[model samples]
Target: MKLSGLKSVENAHDDSIWACAWVPATENRPALLLTGSLDESVRLWRADGLEPFLPSPSTGHCLGVVSVAAHPSGAVAASASLDSFVRVFDVDSNATIGTLEAPPSEVWGMQFDPKGAMLAVAGGSSGAVKLWDTSTFELLATLPVTPPNQQDQQPPPRPASKGSTPGGKFALSVAWSADGRRLACGSMDGTIAVFDVARGKLLHQLDGHFMPVRSLVYSPMDSRVLFSASDDAHVHIYDAEGKSLVGAMAGHASWVLSVDASPDGGAVATGSSDRTVKLWDIKMRAAVQTMGTHGDPVWGVAFRPPGGAGVRAGRLASVSDDRSISLYDYS
Candidate 1:
């Protein structure tokens, strides 16, 4: 499938469009595109023309929105902001369902369980993945990250000349396995920590990128493969279960802010601070098409989830620093 730019809404947001997701269709409406911006608003757009459907702006997020995720059931979606608040809201009614918070820690990326039973938030600077029971909005667990391969004994402290500190860990992005049995989170230091959700134990770390990983997503069809986008301007495909870097796709001239795989698992779309949206052929491990459709840095790009009511053609949505949102036809 190729992408043809359909529409661009300039100044759709006030500041930066940081995150976007597709809200699967309900019985009365087609699938809609949900976008969150640094302006602290979460918006819903009609899928057909990318027009604003519900102007009931979700407010009260004190900081920039960092990530947005829609539950598989089409009833709820969650958003995480720099203020470290995870707001779970109803999709159709535009009502706040729940608000989750963890003190002394900022929030970044987030995802809902495949079965919509839980919400996972990447706890920034907290070195943990926070899970909430969806029904009760109760704190389920905090999965702490373990340092990779350090000897049992603690290492010596660094010299005064060095600026870095010891024992500081920051988590930035998170993904859940399709079966909801496994969870993986990426950190500011470029480490992907895997965990067994059932046991709440650390599994292993997937290492490749040396820069902050901004986004992570698991292929719905193959839970073993994970895609990561980093500030290094490359998308790395990792064997999540095998803990090996399958390959890296690079082309963006600046930080790759967001990366998402097509539901069919054949293509991936990435938004970059370089002011462009790119479509990558996963099998070729290269960018096959580039669309400079946004006037400013593109921060978020998302593929519409499949199997929703009345959903047919593939759809892609992108939000930018230019305060605009762009829609593309992927067919």
Candidate 2:
């Protein structure tokens, strides 16, 4: 699939547009694109022309929004800010549904369970992942990261310096398997850890990136394949079950901030600090097209979810540091 730039809405947001998501179609209206910005607001837009649908302002976020997620049913969405707060709100009514917070760390990225029963937040600098029960908005569990085995038999002695440790795990991004049986989170130190959700045990770690992994997603069609975008300016495809890196796709001139796989798993879209959005053919492991639609860093880009009420073809939305949002027609 390829993308043809459809429309660009300048100043769609007041500050940097940091996150983007799509609310599935409902009987009353087609699917809508939801975006969160450094301006501390979450705005909704019509999918066709990127027109304003609901420009509701979300206050209370002390810092830039880092992530946004939609419930499978399209009734609710959650947004997380750099201040470590997760706000859940009704998608259609824009009513505040729930709020969650954690201490001594920041919340960077998040995703709802496939069944929409729970929410997962990447616990920044906390060396853990936090899960919340959606219905009650209560903190469920904190999954600690396991240290990887060092190649040397005797690893360097733990640093004697204050606040210095052999391994500093800072979770930055997260993803859920297609069946929701597994959860994977990437960290600032370039490691992807997998966990068996039912058992709540650390499974294994996938290694490849030498820099922070900022975004990750599973192929909607295959539960075992995972795609990750990192500050290393490369996308790593992993064999999730085998804990091996199968391929690496590189092209972005700067940090790749976001990535999403197409519903069909035929392609992947990425937004980069290079001020460009790219579409890559996964089979070829190369960027098929690049659209320089944003004047500043592109923070988020997402392919609209499939199987919404009136949506037959695919759509892509991108948000940027320029306080603008762009829409593209995917075919």
Each prediction's whole-model lDDT (CA): 0.82, 0.84
Clashes of 1: 0
Per-residue alpha-carbon lDDT of model 1 for 232-329, expressed as tens digits? Answer: 88899999888899999999998887888898989999988899999999889999999999887787899888765656888898988788888888
lDDT of 2 at 13: 79
Measured by lDDT, the strongest candidate is 2
- In candidate 2, what are the lDDT values of residues 1-331, reduced to their tens digit? 7899888899887898889999877767778888998888788888888888875566658877778899988888888876668889988778889989876455778999899998999887666788899999988888866544532332222221111123457778899999999899987777899999988878988999887788999999999999999888999999999998989999999889899999889999999999999999999999999999998888899988886565787889999989988999899
Q: Pick the candidate with the highest TM-score.
A: 2
Candidate 2 overall lDDT versus native? 0.84
Q: Which stretches in model 2 have alpha-carbon errors above 4 Å?
A: 148-167
Error of 2 at 88 (Å): 0.7
